[model samples]
Target: MKKVTVTALSVVIGVGLLAGCTTKNESSDPAAAGNASNGTKPKVVTITVRENTWGARKDNFIEAQKRLNEDLKAKNVQVNIDWWPGIDDDELVLQATAGKVADVFMNSSVDIGWERDGGLIRDIDWVKDSSVFKGVPDSYTNIMKYDGHYYGVIQDMDASPVFISRKALTGLGWTGEQIDGLKDRVDKGDFIFSDLVNLADDAKKKKLVKMGFAVEDKRFEGWNYAFGFYNYDADQNKMVLSPKVKDVYAFWSDSVKRGVISEGIGDIDTDKAAPMFVKGEIFAEFARTEFYQMMREANGMKDDIEGYNKWFKDNVVWIPVPSAEKGGKPASYSNPAMIFVGSKVDDEKMPYVQQLIEHVMDPDLQINHTIASGKLPVTPAAQEDARFKAMDFYKDHAYLVSFTRTRPAHPDYATFVQGFTLGVDAILTKGKSSEEAYELFKKEVKQNVPADHVIIQ
Candidate 1:
């Protein structure tokens, strides 16, 4: 692993300064050295960084940027962050292709594959030798690789579990013990996917909630959770579309028919759905662990965990999505946020960008960020950090890491997700049957993904 020592960093900074000064002839560039020797500040190399607000705690990024600037101050360089924050994926791609992107950016783990394939991001092959990343788990690092080349560094790990509102469940006359038992049953696969629909239907019929069940309005999320009932062949890197997908679609269609799910759910967005969940309008939805803070604030707990617990108790349940059948495996996804370097960064500025990444990847910073932001740590060392271990939230949900499975990091993964989303939209809005939707999905995948990259089951 490449170790970035104080001496080595100093030399690298010195070389950058010297390189900045040299123009035509070294001796003739007296003004450059004179400015440095006479205490005039050298030119500042401002490295812009753009990060998405989705699943991010903005304050953590701001704090990391401040720390990076503080470390670079001694080297007479500065990092100016041009924070363009939003969850618009298409906007990011447009900026990257137009060479208007920041030097470094944050993106979803799934984007690493196609972005690298499209030449929008640079391959950090040298990261394999970096001591700074040695403590990070391979599970996190491997997701950032495409065709054996590392393209990004994981920023954080989070589990997306199906969150059931405790208040709504209690309103439905569910006892505390019954709510606890529900989670246990789900974990044991005794409570299956069909059972979830039945419960939601019952809740709706009893007027316990306006909407008995809800998934994220996002197309990819909807498809991902629906298809998660099936198995992914990790050995073959193929997605096996389970025969149960037909049943899954039928379950949702029936839910819609019974008024268990929202009528205009196809048009619902996360912003609209989040508030509904907070207001007790929805009984259940799929959300990441990072979203707990939003719920806390909505309930007026405002960083008061104890207060939130007292108000809600065990009313809210966090469990893996139930299996399609009894005794079958339940599913959960670990979607890690990652940082990538833009392909547009010049060779001369690359070292500074690397230095900034090193500063951000510091063990202390990682631990602090995890504690402050409620995002999981990427490295085992950070997870074991004394400060991180002290958080009550981390202690309670840490076991989720063991069961989480990440989607395959294939170069054509983005195409598959898009096709899957389109198929799901057709089923929900166009009155298509599961068989018809799946056939259309297969056709779209075949057309969009390269033959060499396609993995059929």
Candidate 2:
């Protein structure tokens, strides 16, 4: 158990040249293998694991590590988990390129495909095939793969679903049944995006809230998922715009034109906007339950779990983001936290690494971590736990985990987001049509991203 700071540095290693640089480290000696198979004591080995700053506390990891080591005594393996506070994707990428990453680290699956193709992460499909990993569904495992090869394990995820202020609707003289009806429609795939706009517009007209809806433009990927727009074609290795892109663009543009969405929303940061949501300044917005904790804190209930739970029960309601038509798919997307084995790990330590990852993915450990961190559990067994089921927030949103979609696993994903955001803003504020916005999107991607990397259509 160590704490290390990964400082900002400029470094780039050519992943193309480093591809296939890793080697399997299984013991060649039959005597050693036989001894371990027979439960004979072998020399103890330690593997490194890294956890990000945001998810769970240091004490939680330390306690988990202690328990894990106790269980690993029979296998003669141990883990040294390094807690890296405030290390983001940029720093992690730099560490990977420099061959200085830990054996395993928690990261977002959004970058797994990029990292795999860049030769920064180890091929972990073999670990997925092991008995310890067989319980994880293919839907979750598929997101961690690149070119049909697994590079990571999905640890925890939260769908970016829309949250509505029940208090605001109630203030508009709506009954509980009416509010529940809306939620039911949303859940049953009958409440389309147009219905959302109409509800928000009604709230706006009645002055129930200052803004009817809000979305942070910087993280525009959620809307794409809600709209069922997958931008990348894996078969062709090209970035293809969804045929319904214009319809989604028009939906936002119309929301703005009708004053349901206010001006300057492009600058709305989640940190600031989340409080607005709690204060009932906006009727609905995309968020995770983790932010409901923030809302509780904003309402002066930081440590009062009981009060917070009561507040959440009375004021908040969540639903999958509505789609284009009634009976059409209403979907949510996940940016799942993942466990990745670094490419630089030596072959000899692979056995220990597997054991460490298996322990980390254990159902009890996953349940404990999600409870401590306030994230949705990834494992089916963990989801069925009574503690997880007891929380109204988790129970209400748990269904979202079943159908959560992931973003395109390309290295230039940031580029695609930026390009899409630019196009969207043009339609919303610049008075450009969807066709014009499409051109702007194409130009932005072409100028900044590698040409061969994406086929913009």
Candidate 3:
């Protein structure tokens, strides 16, 4: 859910090294060689976009603008984005809501999801007639829909969240069985907290794994999403937090007892967790393909990444988190970023918004996007990109992105997740019982989730 800059992070990791290292866009440099080569600034449109928090600079904005400028130039339009990532996301959201911020902001669909309920955001569906929006899908349109209205544009769609073995599944004792065969024994297609205990015991006997499993029980994701539990049933209007809540905590604790998983699993975010896998301690973990690095960077593990790929060329299997019931489909969730347009702006600005969103949907852009960011693409054809075809991570495990359920679209979503995580962490760390933590969290959520709103079953 971080509205991060792939470009800045790219620079952080030294990706896509821009051709020349020119200091600036002076007439003397070739990196800026294309600056004066284009047509007159098509009205020099100034569009404000939030800056990325990852050390991204105004010049980085200039660079993205430079590329976007080129794209705009091709279509004979002039434009600019005001990059503005800050240290505080909530404060920025407040600023934007108060009309003191940028024109466009990158946030989980919750922004427009809130907007869709009323004047929260403008309905931009009227712009579909614009040439910029030729082939985008209705699925993309559905993301912006709320209460029968479409108000935002969805930029990217990743797979529902998934848990992965740091190594392969066979390492967890799935040997001699096909993926489908392995799928049957796990109740309801769900792998419960207890199943992992037995598996870990088996692995220990075989010296196959260091721990049973890893659980970020309090992760914004893992908290509300532990399988075997029923979340808010909007239609039913009942709260059943404990269905899988106890096991969520139990899974972490038992994993801790088994000693197969990392003790500090849930303490840190992906940045820290990834390294544990790199250290070759944990057998598997949950993450998107973008994190294959942690495993690739194992100490003294050479560029065997190229070699690993050649070997698993078509064997990297992706699977969902096991559910509590055997034969039950495991569910994973992914937060989506919604693209919104300012309703207060004149009708003329509508086309511009369409152009921006449409540009996002551009086939070439999506191809490069999937290549640059390990996030899954919503466009089916985009998956055929040579870059995607070359990636080993997606070879067999590709469908991990196919089964995702969209995250809730409420303004309080983030805070609710934060509260849930803290409560769960207390259950895992402070020895607070799950019932105690869940009770505290339920009260907090009831106070916040609105009286009329429903919590899923």
Candidate 4:
């Protein structure tokens, strides 16, 4: 829970290293890189971090590295961070295979299975016993593990909920009370998925918006939303083509047929769809909390919870993903950003890597990051921390964690996701029935999923 000031340090060694080299060393003093006059040189350990340009992730790593250096200065060991921003997955895979991967990097929960399978990452089984990782829930850790070995520690948690445009609803003649009442209905299972379709259909018929609903164009994300809405079972540790899955396909197909969903929904990327939602061109869409922050920033609100809620309270409505049926469990999808040590890291550097992991996992530091980034905390301790509970944002949105579920953590999870997306696409775009699509999905899963990974029942 130690805190550090955000000082801009020259963390990048040189621009030339970005062309596929594996080292970038940042030191407090430039001359410290050379041996001291006493014939003793400090050991420099370079920790490479790969992340996208979103959120405060890059800053978090830099600050953590600074703290790490402060902690290790007494031991005569200094840690340098090589920051790689905006590196895509394909490039990361190439780097990893060529033995040029970063020592510690950020990755999605879905990548854990494949990365472990490819032997691109190390197994940090000792993390569970560490004090820094003490209160992290198994639900988060399970998603970052392959088989029974821990490969990463969750950096942040997030949930995807349906965001509604209040202007669109009010334009459709709904009163403020009515709009406010929608959240209660959604929570109590009174506002089912079919109800969403009906509302969107009415809005479309009345021409309240050009599209009644929109979803991310990525098939995997869309399927994840559907999986949550349908309450697809994950406890069984196997992919079961549940009969309930048909309801999900039917909903998409029906919405498309009714012309309530965007025709270009399959092609509408987040950047394109976000503006449409803000302008009231779309009534409702499934999106994450980060998107809410983006909208607030776009509207010129100050970057704080008060500013966000002031605008959200008046202009937008947030609700959980509706259940498939009334009185059923409402659910939503969540995924965690994780940090992993690469397979190529030397044994001599493992302890230092653990120290860096521990520094970032501090509950106070995590709460601060959560406040700045709009991501949920990874540990129960952080969620229950005094600072977290005092924030208006946490007070309002913490209820979402109750209904959030991560995708199944099976070793073939990636394959299952791809197959599910393809099957859903077939039902929506092709002239295929739900039965045919399910059959094709089952065939794909069986053919690709390893036999040992499959679970009966």
Candidate 5:
């Protein structure tokens, strides 16, 4: 057996994943197991994975690991998944540089392309033809690739839905039935994007909420898709700075000018947005499904689905971000958690790594994990699971999957996001005009991203 050298961590947008197991009973121990019925010793290997979410908390991944070991034992081999402590993104990059990343780890989808380019992760391009990928959505898988090769296996996908406050709407003279049917209206294209702002403005005017809509000032990746702006054209192999981007900037600036949104919104972080919702300062805000779960935890209902559901019964509802007009297209942003293997794994250990991938991608395991962790599933089977469908935020998020878009997994994606965000920040925080912001956007992208890779129309 080859020595294991890589030690790593898994980080997902402030949310957690799988846990570790510590029991060393011989029945489950790879080293203790041998052919008791015969006289032969079976080959055994241990795989290391980083523990995710809520430091030191036990999670469903332990159950999945147990199942994998049982299955491997049948093949005359035994496996043990040893879990390591988690680390932040900067540390991950540093560790990757030192070739000390864990044998298995996971990170945000947008980071994989660069990780692949830096040769920090292995390219499992064969997943394109593997049965293990069956039922996983392309929106989840596509963002795990870089330069047309798969470097990560999707753990889960999340869509940003516009969360509306029932209490605020009721304050604006909306009837109970109307509030109940709003999601269906948005689904059927009866409620357009403009309708969202219009209603928010009305709510503010009525003194029902201090602000009508809310968003993070410095991070605009999710909102870019929410407004139907795609910054890159993969087929053309160029970044697109269309007129639509300026339109989006103009819309936000106009909203701030109209006093329906907070001027300080541009200064807040994503974690701060939810509290504005809870405090009734905002009538609606674009948020990922995990935001709802965080709310549940905050309200002292963590892990108690019944209490969580009751707490949100009439408190809030998620709706698709409005279409441009009736029957127009709907949009949302999706980001998936991607599991990766360190590139330094030796040939003898590669097959076990492959087995670990297959185990992680299993639809049932994936579905159960998401249900426990308050995330959406990546596969059709997992999406349809009764447990997952039972979550309060499931219907709207699942319905919007057809319209969700993912960030391009370009090697320079982090740089592109920074450039795109700075442009938006200039308008929202720096008080720059839309024209000024547009110019800044063009300059930033052109100066940082390869010229041939960007097209500023």
Candidate 6:
């Protein structure tokens, strides 16, 4: 049997594509197996990656990919992402399961479940040198583990999610007093989905703001935060994953019907939504921390940018969806995107992979990228990275790591995800009640799907 050890009881997130997962043992060519035959190390290796959320078309990610490619080329290795554009998470899951393409897939959550069915392109579970992970904290590994083996490495290590809303609040004539009132209501647990439903409709009719909430519609943030509605059933020891997941669907559907939540959001992709929010029509949104910088860049030529800054002078607030009910901290789940090595590559290159991991692992690298991307650092040490140190959002949102989560740790998590989505559709589009959605969710899970365990690595 391969040697394995529980280094410590690391914190885990109970949400998204990366809940609890497992990976096959890592084999080092000429090292773990004691082969060491090649006098010269393998100079070329191809790595698979997911394009950044904005995709490589964005200058920042494109530049990083360029740098990585150049770095690898200098050493005789070539790294390329099995670039999949215009693809969503569900599609990625299907692709991974079919083993159709991608030797390494990073930036996917559903891939965790596929690992149970022998879907992984490579397994780095047996990585032994602690030095490779030195200075890197336990939190960053959330996306890399499958049953305690490191399978994926992160390309960009941002962990913070930011607040997004529009400058419309400024035009609404609501001074700071009105803003504080809303937050006070939110804090008092007086705000409920029903209430938000009303707010959305009222906003549309009264023009309080455009779209009371910027529905992310994307599975990662907007869709997932909806789960926080009923996510706090701690007796069950896990956040609920059924469609009945905390009235998320019903709330949105009703809000949509009432003209509060935009039906267009259902079709809105990140490409469209980000710009929509930045246009200052959205009341509030869930964003990565870089939103302000994006705003600053937008302001480069006009005083309206100053107006935009004033509107959010203290207003762009970050709020996690309430847990299980309307108040208290909700059981939030989080999963940062990740980088996975390719199975097609031989073990001889594992050392090189480790080197890359180390290079990105530097405190400076982690902090700079975190700031560049407006994300939280995964490492506890990186938490204090100058980026966070300098930002009030960081100091104020101290609860982010302390309270949020990742997907569950299980091989059959994909089925749960599928079922969860079904529940969401039923709730939002089908007018299903919470009870009804939960029943449909449970039925989907109980049906003949993959068991909740992955036997293959």
What residue runs in model 1 are displaced by over 4 Å at the alpha carbon? Answer: 1-46, 51-101, 129-138, 171-174, 219-244, 303-305, 344-352, 367-374, 385-391, 406-415, 446-453
RMSD of candidate 6 to the true fold?
A: 10.7
For model 5, what is the alpha-carbon lDDT of residue 301? 73
Displacement of residue 79 (Cα, Å) in model 6 is 13
Each candidate structure's TM-score, on Cα atoms with residue i matched to residue i, is 0.74, 0.85, 0.70, 0.82, 0.86, 0.62
lDDT, candidate 6, residue 357? 51
Which residue ranges in model 2 land beyond 4 Å of their true spot?
Answer: 1-42, 57-61, 75-86, 93-98, 132-137, 171-173
Q: List the lowest-lDDT window of 10 residues for candidate 1.
A: 1-10
For candidate 3, the per-residue lDDT at 369 reads 55
Worst 10-residue lDDT window for candidate 5 reads 13-22
Clashes of 6: 30
What Cα-based lDDT does every candidate model obtain?
0.64, 0.69, 0.50, 0.68, 0.69, 0.49
Clashes of 1: 4
The per-residue C-alpha lDDT of model 2 at residue 246 equals 72
lDDT tens string, model 2, 182-232? 767876778888887888899889888888877643556666766767777
Runs of candidate 4 exceeding 4 Å displacement: 1-19, 29-44, 51-53, 82-86, 171-174, 219-238, 300-308, 346-348, 363-372, 380-395, 409-411, 446-457
Error of 4 at 133 (Å): 3.6
Better of 3 and 5 by lDDT: 5
Worst 10 residues of 6 by lDDT: 1-10
Candidate 1 TM-score over all chains jointly: 0.74
Winning model by TM-score: 5
Between prediction 2 and prediction 6, the one with superior TM-score is 2
Looking at model 3, report the run of 10 residues with the lowest lDDT sum: 15-24
Residue 266's C-alpha lDDT in candidate 6?
51
Choose 2 or 3, whichever is better by TM-score.
Answer: 2
Tens digits of per-residue lDDT for model 3, 347-427: 776556555556555555655555445555555566667776777565344555445555555545555655566666665
Candidate 5 residue 330 C-alpha distance from true site, Å: 1.1
